[model samples]
Target chain A: MTDYTPYVAAVYGLALLVYGGYTLRWHASYKKLERQLASQSQESP
Target chain B: MNILKKIQPLVGLASLIVLAVGLWYVYQAPADFQQGGAVRILYIHVPSAKMALASYIFLTVASVLYLWKRHEGADILAEAAASVGAAFTVVTLASGSIWGKPMWGTWWAWDARLTSMLVLLILYKGLMVLRHSLDDPVKGARATAILAIVGAVDLPIIHYSVVWWRTLHQPPSLAAGANADIHISGPLLPPLLILSAAFILMGLYMVTVKARQIEASRHLDALEAARLHHDD
Candidate 1:
């Protein structure tokens, strides 16, 4: 009908931002977890 | 190598490949006759919607396992899936609303599918609050598992909402039929498929990472508790 370019951009942009933000958070948390586990294991070892 | 070490590379690489290929397809796909450029929203909307449902299913199964066997890891997995599922649900609802405005002439309707999906998000948030509030892990795990199990009743309602009720939303084209197959048609299929795969890969990576975070948090919390106990 009308130009749906904005709607398309909004959806895709939102998707990219959400996925990217979450992935970064996941990576950071994973690194933190690894460090925690390492320190714990070292203490016990 | 440890499990995380092994999984990290595959997860990272797969997600990148999926994102690259999926976006390439999105760029190349043709416009729909009816919805025109707005149809692109389908790539994200449909996949995230389905993944939201898929995540809930995974959470339900994991919750059942936790309840049945009393395994802490199962509880961790269930909780992780719930968190990811909630995130996906927001994407689905947001994209759907944005797309619906021009297509359906309204941002939202109090339709069955939408309502049930909202309920699912609320349930997920409630579970997160429950997990954090309860000091007793054993009691909390059991309670949350039961809540997850009960919450699963919404899944079928969300899936069949269009068919079961008169709604603005269309019924699913989940399988092959004489007139239809996948919800997407023609050139849109390639990009949509690639994107769907990418979203699923990313979802797996998120869930696994979240599960590990929960476990690590638990360990750190335990250490904190023990240190405090010693000081006392």
Candidate 2:
């Protein structure tokens, strides 16, 4: 009977924040690792 | 190109597109007669809850593969799944609590379903901690895998808790049995189903990205150790 637009929006907003934050963090970590591995390979020989 | 390079981009793009479409469906669906706009929360909450359990099952299976075949890749996958699973569980609990506040009139209750789901979140966190606690990588993987296998008992318990005990939580929504109560249909069901698929694809993409990160980390560790040995 009550409008719960705010509650529904909060859940979707939270989902976006959590998933987006995680994706960006992991993508950045992977890129850093890739760069490190590339540098190491170059230094090896 | 390697298999991962070929598949990861497509999977990532597909997840995003499907998730957008699923959101569109949710937006277009009419409000529930009883719960009004609040029912929209079910679109995210149900899929997240399902994915949380699904991810643990994936981790358990990967753990079995790692233990049976001595596959390092499997261990990496299990690790990736655990992290992703933990994220989904957090979403599930937080979203469920939001929904509960309006419907159940409380933030949380010590019910079987809710408590078991909480236990599942704990198990996932425990597995991650156990994996990193040991100095020896092999020993850490072994202990984590064993714990994963044993912790899988909670999966069945989580699934059946509502049916087995009297609880404030509602019975199964998608699952069918004597205890099944919710029969969502017409405009309401499509968004839920589509979002579930979208969540699975998104979960898979996250797992793959994490697996690559873990693989790279292990390689770096090995290289560092080898250099140390050579210098010594």
Best by lDDT: 2
Model 2 has an lDDT value of: 0.84
Q: List runs of model 1 lying over 4 Å from the truth.
A: A40-45, B1-5, B157-183
User: Candidate 1, residue B45: CA error in Å?
Assistant: 0.2
Isolated chain B TM-score per model: 0.87, 0.90
Best by DockQ: 2
Error of 1 at B25 (Å): 0.9
lDDT of each: 0.79, 0.84
Candidate 1 residue-wise lDDT, B1-232, digit = tens: 1474579679978988997999888888888776678778888988898899899889999999988898777888888898899899999889878877776667885545566677778888998888778989888888888888887875576557643554334443311111121346777788888988998998988888777777787888888788789799
Place model 1 in a CAPRI quality band.
medium
**Per-model DockQ:** 0.70, 0.83
Interface RMSD of 1: 1.3
The worst-scoring run of ten residues by lDDT in candidate 1 chain B lies at B173-182
Consecutive 10-residue window with the lowest summed lDDT within model 2 chain A: A1-10
True contacts kept of 2: 0.71
Q: What DockQ would candidate 2 receive versus the native complex? A: 0.83
